[model samples]
Target: MRVALMITCFNDALFPDTGKAVLTVLRRLGVEVDFPAAQACCAQPMVNTGYLDEAVPVVRNFVRAFEGYDAIVAPSGSCAGSIRHQHGLVARRSGDAGLATAVARLAPRSYEFSEFLVDVLGVEDVGASFPHRVTFHPTCHSLRMLGVGDRPQRLLRKVHGLQLVDLPAAGECCGFGGTFAVKNADTSIAMGADKARRVLETGAEVLVAGDNSCLMHIGGILSRQRAGVRVMHLAEVLASHEGAA
Candidate 1:
């Protein structure tokens, strides 16, 4: 299958390892992956921040970069959610019918990393090994937007030596709604603190989530408080073969 990595702007800029992990694991499975360098932001930041006019060109760039690929994959559920659910609306608002149709064709073809691995590739275990206690946080986008269900945990369950612990209030948002964290600092931090507290209660050595943005938010709180836990992206965990070192 011909697959392309969207490599969302945030991941490219901050959490590059997640994108690398996706590429590593997919190639290990013998599926050739392409990196479309023209790909950039999914315009989620502009759309979510109420800058609709500014998102048009960004959305156009997305559809243009990913249009011909058989499958477009990203490590981020938030950006994937935007493409699948919100990009069309942005296109319509731009008054470009062609752009709207292109987005329609591309959105459904886009899959978040875990979603692509288990759902599209029809494989659960990617033959990974990580001898550590890990708990998962279901970022709101992956749960509600993408509706990935138990795919993330299901894949993790099959990893060799990886223990998947239940996260308390796993469904709650980690309080990193992009601009939500910036505009509503107190509320965002409070919600993140609660999520961090729950993560600590599990005593897991690592906190895993599909979205790096969410992980970063909770990790900040845990790090400042010296919680002694590692924050990992789901792809990184799945990409582990010999062991996560």
Candidate 2:
């Protein structure tokens, strides 16, 4: 199957490792993963921040970039959610019938990492092995927007030597809704503090989530609090094997 990797804006600049890990894991599974050069943000930031008019070009660029690909995949649940759920709204709001149709055509073909791995590819164990006790925080987009129930956890469970611990309030939002963090600093920090406390209570070595933004928000609080826990992207853990130092 031909897969196009849509590296989200955050992942492209901050956490490129997640993108590489996604590529590695997919290639290991014999899937032909392609990186479309024209891909950029799914225009989620503009759309979510009430800048829908400014998001047209970005949406158009995204549609044109991977229009011919068999499937478009991203390592981020948030970006995938944006493409699947928001692109059409932006297009329709701008009164661009052509763009709306293009977005409609492209949205359903996009899949978040775990959704593509378990649902599209039909494989759980990518032969990954990681010797660590880890707890997962289900990002709101993955859980609610995409409704990816337990698919990520199921994949993690099959990893050799990896101990899966239950996270307290795993379904709670990490409070990093992009601009939401900036608009409501106290509320965002409060929510993040709660999530960080849950991570600490789990006593896991690391907190993993599909969305880096959420991980960064909660991880920052844990770091400042000296909580002795590290944050990781789901792809990084899923791509690990015994030989990969």
Candidate 3:
């Protein structure tokens, strides 16, 4: 199937490698993937920050940019959740029937990385091999919004020689709620500090999460504290094989 890679704004800027890893993994799976040059943010930021009205143009651009793909796949659960859950709210809040209809048509076609791999592609192993003790952090959108529970772990477990470890306080929010970080800096830092501590306690060499946004937030604190742990996106780990890392 032809799939459009909806690279989120942050990933486009700070974590381009994650986007590349996602593309490489999908292409390795023999799936047709396209990167639409016109694509931008899914308007998740504006909608999350109580600026639903401001998100209309972004939502429109998203729909227009990805008009042709049979399915939309993003490396981020937050972006996928925005398209699947928040787009309609933004449209209706603005009283735009046409925009809502457009979102309705497009939303169902979008899938988070894990969801597309486990639910649509129907496979646990993407034929990747990464031999390291790694732990997973279930980002809020992936866990609470998308309910993509254990799908990521299932895929990780199938990787040859990969050792998956349980993260302490798994399933807790890392407090990188996009704009929520700025609006509530202290609270965000406190939550991130706690998450970083958990990552350290796990004794895993790598901390993996589906969303890089959360990793960025949690990783910054961990790095600042010199935690000595590496933060990686799931796609990156999933793309690594015997000699690929």
Best by lDDT: 1
**Model 3, 147-210: lDDT tens per residue?**
9999999999998888999998897899889888998999999999999998888899899999
The lDDT, on a scale of 0 to 1, for candidate 2 is 0.90
Model 3 lDDT, residue 53, Cα: 83
| Candidate 3 TM-score, true structure as reference | 0.96
Instruction: List candidate 1 segments past 4 Å from native.
Output: 242-245
What would the per-residue lDDT of candidate 2 be over residues 131-229, giving only the tens digit for each residue?
888999999999989999999999999988889999988888888899999999999999999999999898899888898999999999999999889
Going through the candidates in order, what is the number of backbone clashes in each? 0, 0, 0
lDDT of 1 by residue, 63-144 (tens): 7788789999989889899999999989999898999999888888999888898888999989899989999999999899
Better lDDT candidate (2, 3): 2
lDDT, model 2, position 68? 84
TM-score of each: 0.97, 0.97, 0.96
Worst 10-residue lDDT window, candidate 3: 236-245
Residue pairs in steric clash, candidate 3?
A: none
Q: Please list the C-alpha lDDT of all candidates, in the order they appear.
A: 0.91, 0.90, 0.90
Model 3 spans > 4 angstroms off: 243-245
